[model samples]
Target: MVGNMSKKFNSFKEFYPYYLSEHQNLNCRRLHFAGSCLVITLIFVAILKSSYMLLWLLPVIGYGFAWVGHFFFEKNRPATFTYPLYSLIGDWVMFKDIIQGKLDI
Candidate 1:
């Protein structure tokens, strides 16, 4: 229906499940984690390299890879579309969980 979305999140508990569902496939989740990690590293490198231009393409390099996995591998809508900020947060949280061995992908 593409109805207008509310810009408010009532709770993380509600949002986390949706986040997990959107990234259920192992490959999709792994690709997202890789993209995020690369993006963070790129940010630090950009700062060190004095190449601020790379900052402009961070979202594209990160989300482009992740979205490719979501659409091609997972065949699912990205949580980012429905929950931009929360989904961004979820990406970090999920990445942390993966690093801590609490998540597979």
Candidate 2:
């Protein structure tokens, strides 16, 4: 595994660039975006159908696809392994950026 596992960021803002840097691969970004979208859709479906069980799939869906991207495409350790909170925030922010064309997948 890569080292520097203890590097700390004071805030999500400080972590995002590093997060983006790790996701430079186009396919990795696309997988992260797709995973986030599926997570959002799963949440809505769970709410609308009153099937709370579906909510359990959120982490699997989100992290599964993302891990595949990171491991196979990006070939880097996921930031989530080091910075869970900021990494989560980075996921949504990156998703929004892709949608808004601020970032290209």
Candidate 3:
């Protein structure tokens, strides 16, 4: 598993390849896509209604689906634990890539 490599990346450019590698599973990617979509929707709803509670639920909605994908489908540890900021960026980049047909869902 890539997680076992224990490599440290100097930049997001370097980390993204490893991030993509860890999420090779189709179902895992799909779950991430769904979660990201929900996150965007929830954020919009929170803004529209001025709901701080819904804003707070963002991470839960995002990570819950992502963790399920990683654990059940990908069968690998999520990069989030070790690389929180990068992992969050990776998730959205991946979501865009999938939507734009750069990555398969």
Best by lDDT: 3
- Please provide, for model 2 over 1-105, each residue's C-alpha lDDT reduced to its tens digit, 9 standing for 90 to 100: 343557788988887888888888999999999999899999999999999999989999999999999999988889888888888999999999999999998
Show model 3 residue runs off by greater than 4 Å.
none
lDDT of 1 at 54: 91
Computed on alpha carbons, the lDDT of every model, listed in order, comes to 0.83, 0.90, 0.91
Model 3 clash tally? 0
TM-scores for all predictions:
0.87, 0.94, 0.94
Window of ten residues with lowest summed lDDT in model 3: 1-10
Candidate 1 matches the true fold with a TM-score of 0.87
Better of 1 and 3 by TM-score: 3
What ranking emerges by TM-score with the best candidate at the front? 3, 2, 1
Worst 10 residues of 1 by lDDT: 1-10
By lDDT, the candidates rank as 3, 2, 1
Q: After superposition, how far is residue 27 of candidate 2 from its true place, in Å?
A: 0.3
Cα deviation of 69, candidate 3, in Å = 0.2
Q: Is candidate 1 or candidate 2 better by lDDT?
A: 2
Off by over 4 Å in 2: 1-4
